[model samples]
Target: MTLTEKLTTEFRQRCEGIATEKRSLLNIRAFEPLPADLLATQLGATILTPKQIPNLNPCVVAVLLDSDQWSAGIINQNPLWIVNNPRHTPARRESNLMHEFGHMLLKHKIVRFDPDTGFPLRRQSDEDEATYLGGCLQIPRRGLLWAVQCQMTQTEIAVHFNASQEMVQFRSNVTGVNI
Candidate 1:
């Protein structure tokens, strides 16, 4: 099987596990936004803005590029403190927090920093897995299919899931469900 297929299968299983644990319907027509804050609390994590990080440099927060920035980072693995970018919209912030949660759930190790750039170095494979799983958590395949069956538009699905329009489009593309 192709790598994409393998990843999709695994992510689907993970989503199912989460749904079962949460006692949510697996075939939901309109996916309600997973409360990232609640999830963080359950996972012994706390979400905070970059500026809220104690003793964080103001220049560092100012220099973040909201468009392609590292949306969130799970600092302090023991206590699990997540730092999300404040510049993002609410929907985008939710996705960012979900992505961070993905990493935490997958037990990904703390990222190493590139000394030259003074930035955290990411593993492409890990990032891909987290992104895929995060999307699944936000909009599952069953949920997308249900939306299509219900004749929901991309925008409608985004609103229902509290996700960005671009996230909905991406889900449609990946799941091959026409909006």
Candidate 2:
């Protein structure tokens, strides 16, 4: 299998209620960008929007606060902040934070310096892994299975998961799942 598929499969196994209806109050965010504050809380991480953080770096999504707060998520210092506005869909923001969390979880740190751009460096695999993990974190394969088995249309799943319709459709194709 391809690396993305492998990583996705591994991540899905971590979920306990992939195929069943959840009884917990914690809702599964589909396409909604989780409120930065709430997401930070859920992950035991903190969000330091453009104003809150100092000594920031470029392309730096956010600071991963390890000592306290949610288990993981970003603290984007500046320009990259996309979670604040209601104009932008919540699903997108939630997905972005999760993606950044994947970066921390995978130990994707700046390893070197790019002389050409004078920027910090990271592995391509690390980048890919973060993106893949982010999506899988939000959309577990087993949950996808349950949704499909329930005959939820892609759009409905998108709303249910707070994910975009496109993501839901793509996931359906990727998992060979049917509704």
Off by over 4 Å in 2: 1-39, 55-88, 110-120
Maximum-TM-score candidate: 1
Cα RMSD to the true fold for all candidates: 3.4, 8.1
TM-score of 1: 0.82
Question: For model 1, what is the C-alpha lDDT against the true structure?
Answer: 0.74
lDDT score for residue 152 of model 1? 93
**Model 1 per-residue lDDT tens digits across residues 82-161:** 88887788898878987887787778888878999988999876787777667777787777888888899888989988
TM-score of each: 0.82, 0.59
lDDT of 2 by residue, 136-169 (tens): 6566566678787788777877777777776666
lDDT of each: 0.74, 0.53
Candidate 1's C-alpha runs over 4 A off are: 1-8, 19-30, 65-68
Instruction: Give the distance in Å from residue 174's predicted Cα in candidate 2 to where it truly belongs.
Output: 3.4
Alpha-carbon shift of residue 20 in model 1 (angstroms): 4.9
